[model samples]
Target: MSVSPQDVEKVALLARLAISESDLPEVTERFGRVLGLVDELNTIDTETVVPMSNPHDMHQRLRPDAVTRQNDRENLMASAPAQDQGYFLVPKVID
Candidate 1:
């Protein structure tokens, strides 16, 4: 679980990060601290904890789904440069 300088270097390379030699030790120490925190958290027991989508026990109020706009397909399609059989046409992009 301990993070070494080599481990930090490898992680930096994999993540495409630029870490100078002078900062490698500091970066390794910080990474080790993060891992230690994770290890500490892993020791806690949560078998009795209930899974929840939100911390607050409340239901979201949603408006009823209803159509509010009139259909104007023909008027919209009239502005298109190219269209065919009620469908807008575009130049062929792939073979």
Candidate 2:
């Protein structure tokens, strides 16, 4: 698929991008190339290919879940400007 300068301009406007007049041609050309690649991909037969979460068949390496730090809420809350009921209090910014 080919992309026109008008299409590029419309896309830029929709995306809230500022594309200079001088840069429009290059931008349009690049967009055309990307669309062409997508068009090429559409011609491939993928009826037998199953969708997968990952490209490779492998399980992710995971670490055993364990407590890495001791809870020191009392010591940390002591330095706060204001706190109540196990929660830090801050100035209300919104009504």
Candidate 3:
């Protein structure tokens, strides 16, 4: 897949990018290389390839879900400037 300078300019405009005229050629060349890589990947056969969430076949080790700390809400809330009904009160910024 070949990319022209005009195509890069159009893409830059659409993406709101500030690519200068001096850099346009370089950018276009790089973009063309990326598309070339994609084109190369398209030639690879993957009909027999199996889709997987992970490459490893091992199960994830998980820790037991248990409460490790006591509830200290009242102690923490004591330092708040204003709180009501177990909820911190904040000054309304919008009318």
Candidate 4:
């Protein structure tokens, strides 16, 4: 899992990092170790494992999508800073 200086330089170019030549060796070593850890993880046994999106298995309860009457237009408009006719008025942004 040892990484060469050239490999580090290529990674730097791809990532747009400005790593110096002297620092390439250390960066390569660190990056190689990280990749080695991932390689080790790939060797773990999980053939019969089930994939999970979340820990909880309970589903959300859904209600009927029916509309209900709520005739309170004046109460709704009371919260607006400015209103004209039946629409809320705001500062003009376009010419």
Top lDDT prediction, candidate number: 2
How would you encode candidate 4's per-residue C-alpha lDDT over 1-95 as one tens digit per residue? Answer: 67788888887899999998778778888999998999898899878888767789977789888878677889999999999999899999797
lDDT of 2 at 49: 90
For 1-95, candidate 3 gives per-residue lDDT tens digits of 99999999989899999999899889999999999999998899988988667989877999899989998999999999999999999997797
Poorly placed runs, candidate 1 (over 4 Å): 48-95
Q: How does candidate 3 score on lDDT?
A: 0.93
Residue pairs whose backbone atoms clash in candidate 3: none
| Candidates ranked, most accurate by TM-score first | 2, 1, 3, 4
Q: Across residues 18-70, which tens digit of lDDT does each residue of candidate 2 receive? A: 99999999999999999999999989998999877998899899988998889
Each prediction's whole-model lDDT (CA): 0.92, 0.93, 0.93, 0.87
Clashing pairs in 4: none
Clashing pairs in 2: none
* Model 3 ranges with Cα > 4 A deviation: 47-95
Whichever of 3 and 4 has more TM-score, that candidate is 3
Model 2 TM-score? 0.51
Candidate 3 TM-score versus the reference = 0.48
RMSD of each: 9.3, 8.0, 8.7, 10.9
